[model samples]
Target: MLEKVYPPFIFNEFDRKNKFGLFMDVEKVIYSGVTKFQRIDIFETKAFGKVFTLDGVPMTCELDEFVYHEMISHVPLFLHENPKKVLVIGGGDGGTVREVLKHPSIEKVIMCELDEEVVEATKKYLPNLSYELNNPKVHLVFEDGSKFIKNFNNEFDVIIIDSTDPTEGGGGALYTESFYQDCFKALTENGVFTAQTEEPFIEKEWMIRAYKRISSVFNVAKLYLGFVPEYTPGTWSWTFASKNIDPIKDFNPEKVRNFDKELKYYNEEMHVASFALPNFVKKMIKDI
Candidate 1:
């Protein structure tokens, strides 16, 4: 055991000092190693099933990975008029790629992940989530996405950033204002973008700062709420940004019918409801 360290992604201060933190009881460690980029740990737990963590933070688990993976993939894809090409940055677990492939209209997905090691680990221990990584439409590129997005101009229809904590090794770059500007310029005119911002209950400032960055670059930006059971925070957050499309006004509900039942956490109803923020949450990002 590394002792009960608060995973930094949850927030920098969630420890004995704050007297508040969450812990997942691990029964066994499935795989533990250090990638060149960051530490990787995959553990088995009675409650969360097989879990994956980066550094000391939990990334996803078998029990509830679908909630986040589904929300992140569907909302943006459905929001775009006809999302044929997509770019996913840092979703090495392949969960986001799996959900993106469900839409038949998707012609290609360029997965720009920094660490090939994390992709290999997830594919080996979390096969169900990683199975689609090898699909014909998915291209695996091992590099920094922040740099990769800059090379393209008006290319992808949707861009999803499923990255780790900003404080993790090399992760802070993804949250910067310049990085969002790169993403903003890499998309087609009607493109939609979404990123896993984090849980507002504990990471309100981080969440708002990220939302503000995206809001500055996009013609339209909205903050939506979702829940990841393994994340411990009561409500998780995702930011929806578009070049010219408003997530709600331009939402394509009819497109959801093609893949509705196959999805576990998202549907037409939740698509709209996710954007309806709680009063407290609204107060946090209201100024931005």
Candidate 2:
């Protein structure tokens, strides 16, 4: 009798220019395929359960997914006094939608995902994050987020962009200054917006550019940080921009405490404390 041999799987992410990135050992290859927009893969790792990646960039995993989803969704939602309607661009995995639905004040969420395949894959494999898509309040639409957001005028009260890296898939369109301007025009009065900026270490220059572009369009823009265990440089950033609402002065910590659902990452202290930047980061992006 011949012995059965398991296929070897390795997860690799390399910087296009510098050839510097993460290399992790994979336990199993559960799924892999190429979609119209990008190649998608789902696999198991010893450290991070089932992981989803696009074009070899880790998007989310069973472990530490809450941190990124919570920060990107809640920060902008909580900053607004009453966030009824929200627009979540990209985030086909549905983690952002899960966090957005936590707020009872959210009446409707228009999730504009670029790839329908991403939604199907996550729903089947990453149910913990994608299960919220079944909620009646969520309306999933297949289209370009940058283009779809332009159709509305004074529509959404909160616009949260859960985008993939600009270098991958169809995400580059979402990173442009015009997209931020479109998001600005799509919001109702006193609306707030937030998006996942890059890490301040390896992608410091991109992060600064994002901040400046967003700053140019919105009345107020601020950079904040969060810790994600899986990401390189250990620290991550989110840009919070608003029209006439200040996350620092106007944010009410009591609201976070009063939030009905259980949140793993975001909390009362984090609402204000996250905005307090380290000396190096402040010096890098402050004057802009």
lDDT of each residue in 94-189, candidate 2, tens digit only: 999999998888899999999999999999888999999989999999999988998999999999888886664433888899999999999888
How well does candidate 1 match the true structure in TM-score terms? 0.92
lDDT of 2: 0.85
Candidate 1 lDDT by residue in tens digits, 1-288: 234332322222334334666666667878988888777888787777888888656788899999999999999988877789999999999999999998888999999999999999998999999999999999999998888888999888999999886763334889999999999889898888999887788757788889888888888989999877777665788999987888888777877866644888899999999999988888888877
Clashes of each: 0, 0
Alpha carbon lDDT of each predicted model: 0.85, 0.85
Query: Which residues of candidate 2, in runs, are more than 4 Å off?
Result: 1-13, 168-171
lDDT leader? 2
Q: Model 2, poorest ten-residue lDDT window?
A: 1-10
The alpha-carbon RMSD values of the candidates against the true structure, listed in the order shown, are 3.1, 4.0
Instruction: Give the TM-score comparing model 2 with the true structure, all chains together.
Output: 0.93
TM-score of each: 0.92, 0.93
